[model samples]
Structure formats: C-alpha cells, structure tokens
Target: MSIAKKLVGQTAAYGLSSIIGRVLNYLLVPVYTKAFLPEAYGVVTYLYSFVALFNVLYTYGMETAFFRFANKPGTDQRELYNKVLSLIGSSSLIFTAILLLASGPIANFIGFPERQEYIVWLAIVLAIDAIATIPFAWLRLQNKAVKFASIKLINIVLTVGANMFFLVFCRQVYNGDYLPELRPWVTSIYNPDFGVGYIFLINLVANALQLPLLWKELSIFRFRLDVDQLKPMLRYAYPLLFMGLAGMVNEVIDRILLEYHLPDNFYPNMSNMAAVGIYGACYKLSIFMSLAIQAFRYAAEPFFFSQANDKNSPQAFAQIMKWFVISCAFIFLFVSAFRDEIASVFIDESYHSGLVVVPILLLANLFLGVYYNLSVWFKLTDRTQFGTWISVGGAVVTIMLNLLLIPVLGYVGSAWATLCCYFAMAAVSYFLGQRYYPIPYPVRSIIGYIVLAVVLLLGVFYVPVQQVWLNYLIGLVVCALFLVIVAARERLLFFNK
Candidate 1:
C-alpha cells in the first residue's frame, strides 16, 4: 500500500506538468481551428503525424535501455549515462543534417513542396527533442520528479507563449483586427503567408530552449563511445525500437491513410484534407486520457524497474493496475458523457462533424493505457521481443481495418480501427504477461469498471431527456454514481493504507 502511495504521489507530480501542459496545449486547438481553414489545419495534422513517427526513430528506445541497464547490480550509472547520451547526441546530429539536406525532396514527397521550411524546422525540433530525452530520463531515474515537472512545464509554457505570439497576436495585428498601431511591428517579424508554418517554427524554437534549461543535467554527459556497453544496450533496445515504430503505426497511420484513401467529396462539400482536419481536431478530445497515461508512464517506468527485484512486486503491480483502470474508466465515462460540450468548446463548428469519433478514440486510448501497464512484463523480464510482436500485430490490424473500412465509413472507420487494434494488443499482452511474468492484475474488477463505464456512456447518449440542462444533470449524476460505487468498494483500501 505504501508503494502504491509512492507511485501515486510521483504520478501526481508528473501529472501536474503533463495534465496542465496538455490542457494549455489543448486550448490551441480552438485557436488553430478558428485561425486556419480545415485544409490548412490538415496540413499541420498530416505533417505532425510523421513527426511522431520520426521521434521514435530519433531516440530509438535508448531512454528505456538506460533505465534497464542503470538498475543492474554493480553497474556504474554515470558511465552508462555518458555512453547513452553520447550515442544519441551524435546520431541526432547526423539524422538532423541528413533530413535538412533532403528537406525539399521530403516536402515534395509529402505534397508540400512550397513548404520545405516546415520540414527543416521540424527536423531541428526532432533532433533537439531526441537529444534531450536522455537528460529527462536521467531525471526520472534519479527520482527528481519536481525538477522534471518544472522543466516540462517550462517547455510547454514557452511553446504556448510563442504560439500565441505568432499565431494570435501577430496574425491578429497583421489582419488589422486590433492594435492597428502594432501592424508594422507584426509585419516586420511575421509573414501572413507563413500560415501553418509558424506552428512548426514555434515548436522548433521551444524545443531549442530546452537545451539551456537542461544544461545542469547535460553537464555531466561526456563524449565517449564505449563499444562494449553500446553493443548490449543496442541489443536490448533494438526490439523496443521496432515495437515503438509499430506502436506509432497503430497510433498515427489512420491519419495518413485517411489523407490518402478518403474519396473526394466524401462528406457533403468536404475534401479529404478537410476531413483529416476534422478528425484531428476531434481527436484532441481524447487528450485527457492520453495525458493521464503519459503521466503514469513517466513515473511508472522507473518505478517498475526499481521494484523489479521486490519479493511482493506481483501483488503491488496487481493493486496498481486496479487503481489505474478505475481512474481511466472514470475519465472514459466523464469524457464520453460530455463529448458534445467538449467538442463545442474546444474546436470550431466546422470540425464538429467529427465529434462522433471522440468517444471511440477515448476508449481506444484507455485500452492503449492498459496495454502500457501490461507491457511492464516484457520490459521487466528482458523479453522485449514480445512487445515487438504484439505491437506489430496491432499495427497490422490497424492497417487492414483502415484499408477495408475507410472508403466505406471515412474517419469513423479509422476510429473503430483504433479501438479494435488497442483492445487486441491489450488482450494479447495480458495473456502473454500471465504466462510469463504472472501478475494477479484484478482482471475481473478491471473489466467490470470498463463495462460499467461503457454502459453509462451509452445511457448518456440514448437517455430520453429533451432539455439540455436536464441532460447535463443526468450526465453529472451518472458520473457521481460511478464515483460513489468506486468509493464504496475501495473504502478499505483507502482508509487502511
């Protein structure tokens, strides 16, 4: 129970930055949706999907490898950190240069030949972010959750500030909306034709600032190549790299597929890019679930490694899983219950047509979180190959389903594909985890909470309440009922410990 408390505390610390930062970032969805047309915003969406994929490649699982090896008995963590940082730093430089050189061709390939600068800016952003991962991982491994959160919050704050400066203030001034006196200053710095390019440029500038903030952590990093240590770490991380790539496929390929496969004029008077923009905007509705998972992961990865040798680890893990699912299930229910309100508040009406997929995407992210929890088995046991295969299988499912359904159902098909893929991965990981690592993960209770959440969400959708206020009252009641049941069942766990 104390272990659970510690994990919860650390997660809360991490969640401070992740949840708040993401909410702030989520605010940008409204700004962007309003500022750019759906087609323009779709370009932003399409390009960033590739950014997510390349980000995995840039670090290539080295952060996880550092954690695994650092915890080994008799290991010198400082030297290990030096080696990991050196390898990533060098590789990032090479990768960034190559991408910069090919920026034009790459932009042309993505159908954005006029915007090669976006590719260049994102390349720099990716490299800086990749190199910074080790320092951040080092912070987590050393249990510096406060410092970690502080740095993350700083980065996001700067990112958000820059975004507002360029997108909101400058754009508005340039358009003569307000502050006409500042138009000359805004014009001197901002190009109205830049359009969505500011998003990438601001991101690059924000990521660049992280290097100075992480200077203390990076100061200890020495430029050294320890080939002997490098070989073993690579062996461990290579599978994870593959797994990460496959996982990215499952996560982002739907956007890519939707961009290419949706029929022209599929929606009434909407192009494929417009549809992609709508899907991307609606997808932001799932940010709460994704943020929760990210916070848990930031704390739980190192926690799992530290607890790997404990005699009672299985029980502790089982309890952790129960609480994690309970929390996520509540998020699922709350978000699904208020999906319409959230959509209206966060995105333009032009994008509201895609709101139907928000619940599906939320549930999919819930299962993705479950899969992350279950994946601790492979990471702890040094059987990362299982993770590789499971993620690949999920990616295959995502692809096949998207291909079969996108033409028929559009972005809705992509949402269902996401749900099916994540559910399948989580199920497979659970069975394989039981066979290998064998944690008693309160499977019955976990399933019960999820099923109950789904049923309540259905009630929220189909309940015969004509008045909006009455409907909101019932949704609140449904959420309160869930909390009441959870508190009643888990009273002993809370009070006893």
Candidate 2:
C-alpha cells in the first residue's frame, strides 16, 4: 500500500478510537458533576494531573527510544524490544515497591494522607501502564494500528462503563430494587459523601482490563536481556527523559501550582471547588488539540523513521509539518469559536468561570503541536539535546508566568502562561531546526493561516449579540468563511492543475 493510503487507513482506525474514547471519557464530566460536589471532582482533577506528570517520569522516554533504536538497520528488533522492556519493567517494579512502602509519606506530602490506599493502588496502576508502554509502542511500530486502537477503545469503554455503574446505576439500584439485603455493600459503593474517588477507581479497573488485550503483545517477549544494546538505548533515552519531563511540566504545572499556591480559604468561601474545578473542566475543552496531536504522532513518528533514508524524506517531513500546523490552527479557530457552548457540556454551572481559558489554552496547544512537529527534526537527526534545551526553556517560562501571574490573575494567568510557553518553544524549535536540519517548510502559508485564525477569533470575541445562539451562529459563519478560504488556498497551492 502507498504510504498515504496506509496513513489514511491507520488514522481512520485510530481516529475512531480517539474520538470515541474521548466521548466516553467526556461522559465522566457530567457524571462527576451530578454525582459528587465540585470539590470531590477537584480531587479527581488534581490526582490525575499528578498521574500525568508521574507517568511521564516512570515511562522516561523509553517508548520513543524503543521506536528509534528498534528501527535501525541490522538491529535485532526482538532484542531491542527486550532491552527497553526489561529496563522499564525493572524500573516500574522498583518504583511500585517504593510507592507501596512509602504510600503514607507520599500521600501526606501531597496533602492526602487519608487517601494512601488511592496512592498505593494508583501507583501500581501507573507501573502496570508504564510497563505496557513499550509493548504499545511496539504495536505501532509493527503497523498494528487497528489492534492498538482496539485496545485503547476497549480500555476507554470499560472505564466509562465502570464509572457509570459505580456513580449512577449503583445509586438507582440501591434506591429501587436492590436495597433489602445489599444495603451495606450499596452504602460502601455509593459514597455520597466522597467526591471524585470513583473516577480513579474506574480508571484503575479499566487499565487493569487492558492487560488481557495486550497479552498477545506481551507474549511475544523473550526473557533474554541485552546489555550491549541497553547501553546505547539508555544514552539515547536519557535526554528524552529530561525533555519529556520538561514538556509535561509545561503542560501540567499550572494545575500543580494552583493546588499548591491557591489559598485554602478560596474554595469554601467561594461556595465550592471554585478554582480547581473550573481549571480542570476548562482544561478538557482543549482535548481536541491533544487528540489531534496524539493521532498524528501515532502515525507520523514511525512513518518518519521508516522513510529516513529516502531522498525525498526532508521534503516529506516539511510537508507533514506544514499540514500539521494548518490542521491544528484550523482546529484552534474552530473550537475557540464555539467554546462558550462547549463550556456548557460539562455538568457544573460553576465551571463556566474558566471558559475563557479554553480558547487561550486551545491556541497554546496549537503552538505545542507545532513545537512537537519541529522537535521531530532533532529526534530524526539524533541531535535530541536540542529538544531538552527547548523544553527546559519552555518549562522555565511556564513556571515563572504561573508564579508571577497566578497570585494576581488566578487561572487565567496560568492559561496565558501556557500560551506564552508553547509559543516560545515553537519559535525556538523552528529557529533551531533551521540551523540543524533545515526543511523548506511553507512558513508563509502557515503564518497566513495563523493570522487568519487570530483575525476570526477577534471577530468572534469582539462582535457579540445578546442572544447566545445568535452569537454562536455568527461565530460559526465566520469560522466557515475562514475554512473556505483555507480550502481554496490549499487547492491553489497543491493542486493548481
């Protein structure tokens, strides 16, 4: 099959899983809003943010490293996999052991000592998921997008179904037919008092369910560990570990800073989990950008490596990067135009306070996606240190802005910080990539699209009608005009024939 066809097929399969998976996960927002207080859901938000950061730490760039080394000529593919797998497995084993032993101290440090069990179970969950990361990447390397997406979709379905059972159906069952002898079990399950603990429990269970689906991949493993290959892969992966850590800090440090710096008195005085919940819910509004980046990376990473020796490889990479920027800019403009209504999709009315962050953060993620595309040049050239420096710089900018601005402007400051951080990283990567592995990207056209997006965003924000529906209708028309212009420009550039 042609690469284009393969990509189209792979993306379609993965996109279904991604879109469906996000839909299922989005269901949890409403569930939590109705089932638990905003404060309770805030707990869910905080822990998962921490989970995202630690998952990056525990995986430690090995998934990408596995793909890099495993694709090299004359490399023992199986041995390469085994080396990385063993490394991650051993690290996870040790990490889980420590987490189990030190759950109390860890929980206390995070200010939730009473939820040590949460820490313990989730740490195991993270370890399991981390160890599975290599196998998942292997599936992608092997062109197993269907199976890969199947596993992911199944995981999402199981998670969403379990959460519904726990938070919604469980109450209905207890209230209706199952109340007589099951009262204690029902009461234990239906913690009307607790907030968003059920979401974590459901995630833990869903992630556990993925083990059986991954058994086919796991069974391919040989027990042989290759120390010779391990040394080089470790060398390659170490910089990525720092880069990944810095990247995630850019993505999530806002939530961490909020939890740490926000006054304890703010929530109850404000009549709810005001700041955290708002930030958390508004964050979800950017899932469009995240999902687009993820789906593109799934295909693009291996695709780029596979074609590394082609004479046209640089041209192809440039094209891919341009298209990625164009699509992401389009999504940013599209989503931002309708964010006011999109903000209402989550259950709690109070969360609407953070809606303004959605458009800002969506654009930040646009820059972030572009930065990812640019950073790939460093990875492809094996000059990965550039990625580390860029990400660290971005992280520093993100932290400084959050610290300086959050005290004065609250979550909006964090959103603006994210935008600035990503914009800076994208700029740095573009300039540095030109120095190292220059690809003649369509810089003019890409910048044109960005300018068009910004102009349309201004139209949406500045031109407002009192009726919400009319305002949104006008915004959609404005976005469609931009889209039509984009489509015309793309055709003229690529298909003037």
Highest TM-score: which candidate? 1
TM-score: model 2 vs. ground truth:
0.94
Query: Which residue pairs come into collision in candidate 2?
Result: 40-195
Residue 400 lDDT, candidate 2, scale 0-100: 98
- List, residue by residue over 231-340, the lDDT tens digit for candidate 2: 78778888998999999899888888887776556544552245776788788889988888877777777877787777766676677666777788888888888886
Best model number under lDDT: 1
Question: lDDT for each of the candidates?
Answer: 0.91, 0.81
- By summed lDDT, the worst window of 10 consecutive residues in model 2 runs over 265-274
Give the 10-residue window scoring lowest on summed lDDT in candidate 1: 488-497
Each model's Cα RMSD: 1.2, 2.6
Which segments of candidate 2 are over 4 A away from where they belong? 1-8, 172-189, 263-268, 271-273, 492-497
lDDT of 1 by residue, 385-449 (tens): 99999999999999999999999999999999999999999999999999999998888889999
